[model samples]
Target: MENKKIILIVLATLIIGAGLGWLIKPTEDKTNEISENHSLESLDHQEIWTCSMHPQIRQSEPGACPICGMELIPLKKEDLGADPDSYQMSENAMKLANITSEIVGMGNASKELRLNGKIQVDERNAYSQSTHIPGRVESLSINFTGEKVSRGQTLAMVYSPELVTAQEELLQAASIKESQPELFEAAKEKLKNWKIGNTQIDRILANGKAIQRFPIGADVNGIVTEKMVELGDYVERGMPIYEISDLSKVWVLFDLYESELAWVKEGSKISYTVNSLPGETFEGTISFIDPIINSQTRVASARVEVNNKDGRLKPEMFVSGIIKNDNTDNDTQELVIPKSAVLWTGKRSVVYIKETVDGRSSFKLREIVLGPGLGDSYVVEEGLNSGEEIVTNGTFTVDAAVQLSGRPSMMSPREKETQKTNKFISVTLSEKEKQQFEPILSDYLEFKDALVADDFSSAKKLVIILDKRVKMLKTSELKEESAKIWGTFQKELIKSTQSMISSNDLQEMRNNFDELSETTIGMVNSFKLTSKELFVLHCPMANSNKGAFWLSESSDVKNPYYGSAMLTCGEVKSTLK
Candidate 1:
């Protein structure tokens, strides 16, 4: 009975343990499945990191940038849309570069014009002191230049024989006043002609003596600038004895360049300070602006009149001033940007416009028709609107990035259509000539792309291929008329190709590229391309703003002239179909 009971206990225990194990196994499997799903969800949310200094660096995980070795930050999630015109920068990059922008609007704009000037004597206030009587200077009270003299103060005592004769005639005339009234009046007039005061004549008549010495008095109150006479020197009538200038009112003359003329105007307010007078400020108005620009100096003088009654401002003292002009004229109020935002190349002024592309800030380099320059800023005549945002600082930094990306910037003005005269000649070509010319055109394109990338070494290598291809053309296959055209085109091609081969300088290469492009276009027009359509692109900012043209396989403009400075500064003019 005991053995049977033990067996029943064992069977019951086994059955209960099996039930508990089955329930726990399903719960553990469900927990493991949930954890695996969570891991997959986290993987889907992974971020891509990029460097601020180097926009080209992109990575899936956070780390240092390969190019600049800067800490990488998470790149904002957005579609990497292809827009060749715009240079996209991540928010992290903008922050790293300290880039900032403002929504430009039509408003009153002002610029602080810092100019260097010098204090000068007002030419209108300058005076020349002359002697009225021919005499010998007996003694001079004004001994040296810079001596201050008041009006009516005696500058010198002179002995004049003419004055003595006049006095003698006056005395004789006084005695014969009843006999000859006209003679007495003539003698008094003679004395007056010599600047003899009536008081001195009365003293002579009262004392009954002929005066030997005459007093020369100052006509104006001023500091002597030039002493023309010495003690005991012989003087002629109407000869200047001294040059004096009133410094109470001084002029601060500033040099304004021809480009700066638009902002400076007569009656503009000026605040200035002289190096000689530290910690003191003086204010004045621009009294004169020379209308004529100096051809040699390319500058004009802007004069400011300041009161120097306290004598703090000295002549020839160096001064610095700020010219304040309202610059709120109708034309100027259209649009304006800070000078720091503009990159000027000859006549072309360019600014980088910030555009939002797929939630990222992208900069597009745009050429603007500039109006008057208002000191630290420029008036925008064209190419921008009221609400557009532009780079106010770190302009060069953004341009550098554009260059690396092969886009346009300041050094490269955007492209425009070529003139009708610059167009390729419309001449048909024989099959053999077409075959010979097309390869050369292709090589020329390669050379152009090398230059666009600013790879001088690669450009040099491609130029060799261009030279070889040009020489490979055969003149025998064409008829007389076709051969002549071929000869002309070949000569231009060889000349331009040779010019490129001879120079290692990137700038010179770009210069030669202009001629190369023109000749290639002519060749392609004469004998059409068999493979792809060619684009005749022109950059208005190239070749010192005179503009230049180049050929490319794609419609996109890659300016060889500016290279990295303005990588994308051109546009497609027409296609060689």
Candidate 2:
């Protein structure tokens, strides 16, 4: 009977325990579920922020940018899936960056070419102060260069053995003048040949001894530019003692570049300002144009004569001149764009065209053909239409956004298929010049293969060889317009290769290789130098996903940018035959 009573007690205890556990389970699980729901909701609501100046920076919360210390802004979803070719900027970001845009229109095309030059001496009025007799310079009346001397002014004193002998002959002839009048006349004629005046000869005859030192006089009133002989320095007869230039008239020689050669004529009117003299404007007509272009400076001179009786304009003084080169072509309307809006390379002008779609402003980089420069503006020859708006101020800011977003920027030479107008270099290559690029093309292909194989050393050597071949390409036979284009392309090509040569790492060289490929593609298209089949391959994942091209002798894909990691990450973009 006691055992049965204990069993009943145990069963009752078990039943009570089970009932208590069931009662607490629902409440506990419900509380935990609520906590998890709250946590997930808070995490989902978090926003992403970035800096306008530094777009690469991304943060989960609002804060200052780590790189540039700029205030972070919320990355708007408005441009999330917008046009790939355009850079969309929020209104708030534009205001914070101090960016401004302007609407452009067609106007009368007038270009004012501004040239930098300096005041120079007129060659016509310049004269050499030369010695009539061989002598050693004893003393100089005009001690230094730029000292003024009047006509017949005693420039220097020279000890001349020839003049002393001539004077001695005069003295000897004067002693026997009564017996030999002809000899006396001949001796006086000899002194006159040495530019000796009658008074000086008479004084010498009065002294009855040869004058050891004779005075050299100036033939023209001018400033001495150069003193060729110093004290005790021997000079030859008819040798220049001083280079003197007349200040009554001067030449304002403006530096004329190869691109500006066509616009400048022999009689173009120019209005200029001297840097030394403020608030004064001078005007003159271009009197002469240099026949030969200077090899080193690659510029010619346009001479403009100016009357300077007041001696205001001095030699070596910097001057800014403007020439109004009116465009006579009435068929093409002039679309003037702000100079600040344009980002220029050697042969290209880039502008950001702004278009507002659905209240979101998008900027697209457009390469334009620049016409004549109008002081602070440029005439748009191509790549733009009237009534278009562009980024006038803070253009670089817009370009930066476009560049980071993987669109065409000033540095990236991206070619868009849908582009309305293409950049026209207006260039051609001769047969000999085309043949000259064979070794260049051969080396370039090897360089591309080296990068594809991830061989940095081989690429360095091949690029160096390619650079030499490019530099040695004969461009002298190119016509004026063609030469200008060739020079621009050549400089950019060399610059790209030189960057690779100086790179410290393989990745850096590959980055420069894209630029090299761009310059090569441009040259090939314009020059049409290919004789055999070649392929232009493009890697969409190259240049930080902005896309890059490389020349290949074969149509097979071999990615130079990604190398062994993504060897075949390219497509045959085009073929050249």
Candidate 3:
């Protein structure tokens, strides 16, 4: 009876344990299944963080950017079904990007060209006060640089022996009127040829004494621009004693840039002001437009005739003026935007357009055809429509983000892919090649670090190491495209090193590092990896020729060969041992 009772207890305990295990197992499985589903949802809605200044910097989690070290912001996905290349910024994003918009329409529009000019003497009325007879300056009446003088006013007294002789001949001719009529006439004409007035000749004859000196008079009623002679100074015949200009009418010379030439013409009205006379507004009519442009400044001169009866306008005084072109009849308007809206890539011009739908925003980069540029703005000839919003202030930051997102951008993504792939191939280098390439990369890193520190000595030492490594590479596994790439890189490195050795300019050295990084990245891109398993060791900072590492999937993106940056940001093919 005791054995049977123990067996019954064991059976009952086993039954209870089995029931408990079955009940808890389903709960555990359901909890695990819920956890897995949550993880999948999180993966689907993962957020990407990017920097405003360095767009190529992307982090799976929110943090600061590695390139510019700026705080990263979330990149929101657009719901507007916009083009994949387009980015729409929310109201907040627009504010952060400093995006602004303006409505463009057809209307009669004219540009006001502000020109810088100076008060100049009317060249047409300028004359030199010169003496006809060779003589010594007995007295100078005009002594200052800007003294006013009148027509026929005595500017200087010149004493000449030639004039005295001519006067004596005239007196002798006057006494012998009938005996030698031709001789008398010839002598009188000779005295007149010496510029002696009739009154002076009559005085000499009446006094019965020859005068050795004559007064040099100004030819025009004007101011003395230059005084060339002083009292007691000897002057040659026909030499100018003073430079006189008629200031009653002066010229305001306006320097017009090449673009302003189309609107400016002869007889166009202009309004001008001088800093010295603030309240007094001066007006003039354009009388002349210079046919030739100044080569150095690419500016053409426009001469405006101004009345200067008061003599307030002086030569060489700086003047500012405006020329208004009338476009009232044309009725055609041009699309214009701020000059800051355009991005110049040396070869191509670009602008970022924001597309908004249902209050959501995205950005799209558009290539623009720009016409004549006005002050602070550019006339849009094509690429943009009547209504488009553009990011004026923070386009560079946006482009940086576009590059880091592994999307097609203004820069070639394929080139970046090629660089990344070639870096992976570089890992399969022969032991000797590795030895040669290792030191080169190490030196490049040192140079980059030194540059960041602004340390010249350490940078120079690293540059020398790179120079030596490149020289060694000239004889090693350098062949085909790799050889060409390394050869070009070596040449640039040598040039940069030479620049550093010759000059102590830190900026120059930094520029050399930029070139070196570019060349090395190109060298890395020239090689292809036959085996996917092999990977190259690369320094993100040292390898970047354009100065930033960019994450991209397209091989066509601009790499070191085409852009300013060398290193590409993307998934690592294999970890560096």
Candidate 4:
């Protein structure tokens, strides 16, 4: 009986062990298979290394960048195949580059006013020194411009015939004062009319002599700004002999731009600096605001009164000034960012926000409501918060990454597509004529590449070349639909290129070029062309040799290859190799 029980226990134990093994065996196999697949994927998508400062420098293995000499950082495996112009930094790379971002917040709304004006003589203190008598200038005491003078100081000697006659009449009247007392009084009054002082007249009367010439004295103390007559020069009646300006008080004129006009008002205090006096600063009070705005610059003039007792400030001196606006009335203080931080897109503005996961850095896009731009910064109207970090420098790179990810950026993808469609509809290109159309498309891509590299000279050259090529293509053979589409595309491309040319913003030119290239490529893909037709009509002058061509028959039309086979001449091929 004991032997039988022991056998049964042993058999049961064996059965239990077998069942456990069956259940656990598949789970281990599945885990191993998943691990193997993950390893294979990682091998295919190996990380690349690059420099932050020199984005163009890329290496398959990790090390320092030769150009920048900064430690190379591993690039995200997923972003390895992104556009060359588009920059994408991995978490480690962002930290190494010291790149950070923050959320945007609303801040107080205040106006920033930029005023421009020149230095001018104070109108109240400016005086024109002139001789009252009709006479000839005998000698000028003040000979040069900017010579200082004092009140009652002699500026010139004038020999006036009328004054000589009046003085002689006074002497004659004095001799016969008892017989013609009224005549003596009239003669004294005539001397006073010629601006002869009472002391000089009394001396002349006491000496019984008639003074032939009188000294022209300065009426107000100032500097000689205009010397009208030289020594021994003939002077006309009531003609100005000299122009004088009192430097004790002066006016500083500022030209305020249209946007800054609202913040600057009469009586605002301003601080200024002159290039001549680098370290010295002066303060003034706003006294006047011009009602008219300049037609060309759209700026209004603002006048400020300055005290220049030291005579350091001179008229026509270039001055740079700042006005501190009182934000007391603006009850709300909102988040503020540097003007350079906001990227404008005609209708909207965008800012890049830095995101952190357990202190690991990443970048994200944020649309912002932008207020008027201050001299160096901007007040955030909305879509931001206080203490949030943002990408102040290298924002263009961040924006490019956002665009590559197919995210809604400052400009929507839908809008871009619509614009491209409209442009394609306006161009005049034949459906079957691939030679002329292929070159235009190829030229656009080259222009885009040049722009991305910030090579303005190359971009301009490409633009000119494209224009010439378009001109050479015969419009007679073009189909109505094709011509209209080509026309629209050309118009838009021309407009964008022209804008870049005018502004001279290399970055904007580059961005526009990218848009144009993408739009052209998309249109080509949508239109469709077969592999055989594409090879026959391919762009011969293409830099990358990746352009497709259309065939004479509609039935042969197919999708152009994109992605891995971007340069392949085929019907949407998955890979080129």
Candidate 5:
């Protein structure tokens, strides 16, 4: 009985110890589960949120993009695996934007160069009818301009006292012809000096009387453009009496701009039409191109000699012409792209290349070298492959997205230091020219500020002032290189300012500002501003997604393109010293 009690006590103690150990182990497992939950909560707090349109805008928590005011979405870890130089968008977003791309390849490209010109009289075929004898006009046969006259036709009758005296001498000499034969020949020679024909001399000798009045004959068949003599008008020898031109051949002088100088050559063929002659077409070959380009007009004349025997083409008639020129030499093919695919920033030509990002569509902005502009397209010289895909339509949208993401774009670059090194020869201006151009810069800043504030009326008023200031630029003192730059800027400034002033809508004015800023920036860079410290600023949301740049007196960020929606959205791109 004693042994049984000991064994029961030991068994009871063992059972109690085992049950307590089980309860303690459950508490430890619960603690471990709580710690794991805490770690997961910490990871959730570290998530990053960003705007889809503006991926550059990053926040620790959910918020809106600072630049575009777009709602921020959570960034996934898988998105980080995409290319750093490219950007990604959803299929729905791509469809909504209507973005399209095409594969560039080599092909033969030709451009039709349209030119305006006028028909002019062939200078070589023109002549001036003049008299050889000094006389007084007795009667006028050709009364007005545009009267056609034939060769050897008598145009007017003149009375000459000298001729009558000479005839009298001849008559006297004829009386002593047997003894003074030399005298008779001498009198005949004097009449010949006055352009009197042999027949008229014979008639004078036959009649044996002095003829006082002489008839002046036309030298060539032509229509009279000017009559220098009137009835009873005294004229001197060698004086031009009538200005005449033959319409057998005519010259078509076409105005060629500096940009078109390359395509037009001496032997190029051209087909033209005139508004006066409906449903009629004329063809001619270029005979000559003016060696000198006009300073004011910035154009040269291309001459085409055309046979106008039919008289269908008249002088001073306005005409239009088309010149079909091949875009290459040696007939080799080249890569070409539509003009819409390019984003010209004055300093650079950029295109957005399509890329695959995380198994989806994306785009990367790339700089390219352009060869020739073939009307609606351009030939690619460098910076692209033969089979590369490029954005052909809605390129502006892609560029805008690239800018919003703070990547290299038409207006913005990832590394601005690279752009600071300019390859183009710098245009230098004198101190006087720079001083005179300071007011233009001031007026431009004012216009830019108005657009930034989204004040259309103020912007229009300021653009008017800006236009006058740009027009007032003293281009007279500029050197040849500087004058070329000035000419280019003047054309662009007039176009932009006029467009801005005529537009009442804020968006259009902003669009005009983009072009205006491009010209202004180029001017500033080429001339090297001195009076003020100009800062180049950019706004990615302007011009319907195409980014734009503006000049500012200060480095402070003021969103001129976005206005009150996002007041301070841009950064200083460069400081012009």
Candidate 6:
């Protein structure tokens, strides 16, 4: 009876325990099931982490960016839909590079063209003082050049036999006034014919004798610029006695070249300063522009009339002037950009335009057509509009960054320059010059191959040999522009080679290889130096972000810019066959 009672007690305890276990176990199991379902999805891309600001950093797990110290974001977050052709740079990157931007808008358009000029006598204000009656000069009132004279001022005294005779006739006629009244009037008129004023004639009659010497008076107020007569000098009627120039006004004449003719016009304002009088600025208006250009000088005179009552401005004084275009016609708006913002490639003018892409600031390369240059700025005729942002400062830095990222850039070979890559220049070369050039091309290819193989010593040695061969080339046989073109590229090529030779570092050697490669590519474009068809391969990842071009004997790309790190980082951009 005791054994059976114990068994019944144990069974009752077991029943209660089973019911508690069921209730408690379900809560843990349900929680664990939910976790297992999400575990696979969580591990999808969360295992590895990187910084959003710097994509170069990588870690096994989440932390901070080693370079920038920004909080590490999941690698999956970095797939921000960045454009392939645009350059993606974080705000931190821009700040580090000292990059700045500005909004493009139209404002008052103008340019200040600095010019050189000279002060001159106003043609209308210059005069020639002349003697009216023929005579021999007895005395001179104006003795030297630049002597001030006024209208009706006696300039010189001259003795005239004809005037003496006319005076005697007038006196004789006056003696018999009642007998011959017409004769006396005719004698007075004869003296008047010689420009003898009525006042002077009356003075002669008052003296009651024929005056031996007559005085010549100035006709206008001026300074005598040229003395045409000396003491006791003989003079004829209407003979110039002195050259006089009015000092109250002057003219400033500026030489306008053929290229600068359109910028200046009649009535344009000019602010000028004379070399003789420093720290003093003067203003004037353009009174005239020569209608015809001087054939010998290839220039036209732009005249500015200035008041010279103070007599400070002297003739032939050098003057420097500035002309600022007014752009007063506000009806049309012109787009102008800073000269620093433009990347002027021979074929295309480009700028880096800043825009928002994927909720982040991005800079894209854009080609623009440029108009006339406005001193420190350029006019944009096409490819841009108002209200857009552009990289104004550190534009080359941005382009370099974009270029290193494999985007188009100023140095990047495009379809325009590449289309004519196969068009070899028609420059004829002598057989001896061609023979000397062959080994140079061969050595260049070897130098490139050494860089591709990361052989530093071989590269240096081969470049030295290449430099010698380049120096040996003689261009005396070539003529005209062809010679100039060859000289330019050849000199550049030799310089790059010398740089590579002096560099003890492989990276530096590779850096200089960029210049060498471009020159070689240019040479290949202009000449078919080898029997084998040469290939112009471009490595977008070369030159630390600036794309580079290299010549390869084969179609396969062996990038010399990156060496073994990215031997196959490029492709054939163009070919020379």
Q: Top TM-score: which candidate number?
A: 5
lDDT of 6: 0.80
For model 3 the local lDDT of residue 230 reads: 81
What RMSD value applies to candidate 5?
A: 15.6
Model 1 TM-score on a 0 to 1 scale: 0.59
* TM-score quality measure for candidate 2: 0.51
Superpose all Cα atoms of candidate 3 onto the true structure and report the RMSD in Å to 1 decimal.
13.6
Better candidate by lDDT, 1 or 6 = 6
Please list all clashing residue pairs in model 1, or write none if there are none.
407-567, 407-568, 408-568, 408-569, 414-569, 415-570, 415-571
Each candidate's TM vs. the true structure?
A: 0.59, 0.51, 0.58, 0.53, 0.60, 0.53
lDDT for 497 in candidate 2 is 86
Local lDDT at 321 for model 4:
84
Least lDDT summed over 10 consecutive residues: which range in candidate 3? Answer: 550-559
Candidate 1 vs candidate 2: the lDDT winner is: 2
Clashes of 5: 1
1-577 per-residue lDDT for model 2 (tens digits) = 9999999999999999999988866786799999999998776566778766445557888987553345788876665445556788889999998899999998777667889999988888889889987889988888789898899999889999889888988999999999999999999999999889999999999988989998898999888998888888899989998999998888888999987887788888999999888999988899899999999999999999888999988888999999987665666678898899999888888899899877888888898898877668888889988889999999999998788765668887464422111353635667776776677777888998999899999888888888887788777767777777778778988999899999988999998887788777777777786788888887765776567778888887878898877676666867977
Once model 2 is optimally superposed onto the true structure by TM-score, how far is the C-alpha of residue 67 displaced, in angstroms? 36
Per-residue lDDT of candidate 6, residues 409-489 (tens digit): 677623332332333355555565466567878998898899889998888889899998888776776656667777877
* Model 1 CA deviation exceeding 4 Å by range: 1-81, 84-89, 97-102, 165-188, 202-209, 246-254, 274-283, 294-298, 304-319, 330-332, 344-349, 353-364, 406-577
lDDT measured at residue 358 in model 5 versus the true structure, 0 to 100: 62
Query: Residue by residue across 201-293, what tens digits does model 3's lDDT show?
Result: 778878988887788887788778888888898889888888888888888889988778877789888888998899887778888999999
Query: For model 1, how does the per-residue alpha-carbon lDDT over 363-414 read when each residue is reduced to its tens digit?
Result: 9888889877766767788988999999998888999988765456666544
TM-score of 6: 0.53
- lDDT, residue 573, model 1: 70
lDDT of each: 0.79, 0.83, 0.67, 0.66, 0.83, 0.80
- Flag clash pairs in model 2: none
lDDT of 4: 0.66
